[model samples]
Target: MEEKKIVSIEDRIPKLKEARKKKANRRLLFYLSIFFLLIAAIIYLQSPLSNIKHIEVTGNKIISDEEIIQLSGLSPETNIWVINHKQLKQSIEKNPLIKEIKVKRKLPQSVQIQISEHKIVGYVKSELEYHPVLESGMIINKHNISNKGDGPLLINFDDEEYLKRMAKELGEIPDHIFNLISEISWEPTEKNKYKVVLYMNDGFIVHATLRNFASKMKTYPSIIAQLDEGEKGIVHMGVGTYFEKLEK
Candidate 1:
């Protein structure tokens, strides 16, 4: 067997140096990668690519998209990362017509606004124009009677309190029954100040008091079902529920 050769510490020193250099190179590459990533992040945040480029509004009827966007307090200059959704929603909901709203950020650079408006129950006539009345008791003067369909017509009822009560009662009734009502005239009597007459689209008249209009009118379908199909007249639920057939 050949004699075993002894390796000097000087020979191992070169290998140790090469290993240290490799470790340092790896560490330097890691730190450089981290530094470049941080710089890229800063650039992405400050660039116009991070700004809001699109704003979309939906579920608006009376209010226009431009009007809603103006109310939202959001502009093209706004940064998508710093949007306060709650504050923006509150601002848009300040309009009486907007019952609810939602704001969301789409990926890249876009914002979406969803709105739910109050239900328009009827219209009140003033001169030749008709103002739309919402379920929240607000009257929108933007529309006229000609622009509207056959909704309730309020006669001699201008009191906001009374109108609110009327609107509340009308809202409680089912849509099927509510749609049948063509006109409503508030005619207060000495005995009952809340008395009103409803003219149905089916050519039948409804006499009811605002006190229990919703409760009483709920039985309207059953009452009409019991009557003859050929018969048409007045349905009186003002005091006790009864029917009066009009003789030809």
Candidate 2:
């Protein structure tokens, strides 16, 4: 019985050694895998592959891509993982022309910037330059007047308050009616301080008050259609709608 017990003990010892050897091999493999993964991560982070390779700008018309990129403070040197999205968005939106902006990261290589710009309603003349006026009643003081095609011109508007209100009113008008107006001149009287004179593209003058100008101008197309062919006159739209024939 003693001899049999000794042989049984001997058999268990070899089995335990095999189990310990297998466990050690697994642990070594796990450590080696982690080390290799760390090395690969470090290599990728230091390489240009982790840098921003493409910067795409969309939904920009008046503000060019170069302008937007310059404002964002983003470049090919910017790392993909370290992008400050909020700072970038706030920077781009500082321009009066930009209403809102969205910044997005396309992992590994690219970033995209999308922007919504304020609608440019008209141009306000300042000295020899024509500055763009936005729908939000803000005027951009850019000097390059030839960058955009001509639209309605705001003339003789000295009061900033009235000018802002007029810009908002013009923006609210439908495009068809807005396009017909060639110029808007502020001509206030003692009784009506908000009076404005609009020169139409169709060779007619419009007398209107800024109070309900957009609502009243909706009927302009129909009124002009009722006039005689080649007729020239001043259309009164403030108190009531009527056409006064111009003296030949």
Q: Say which candidate scores most in lDDT.
A: 2
| Predicted structure 1: lDDT | 0.85
Question: Candidate 1: deviation at residue 214, Å?
Answer: 2.1
Error of 2 at 11 (Å): 11
State the number of backbone clashes in model 2. 0
Summarize candidate 2's per-residue lDDT along 1-248 as a digit string, tens digits: 45553457778999999999999999999999999999999999889999999999998877788888989999899888888988988888878788888888898799999999787888888779888888877878852332484469988888889988998898789989988999999999999999999999989999999998899999999999999999999999988889999999
* Model 1 segments more than 4 A misplaced: 1-30, 142-150
Candidate 2 residue spans exceeding 4 A from truth = 1-39, 142-146
Report how far residue 222 has shifted in candidate 2, in Å: 2.5
TM-score for model 2? 0.81
How far in Å is the alpha carbon of 34 misplaced in model 1?
3.7
**Candidate 2 has which clashing residue pairs, if any?**
none
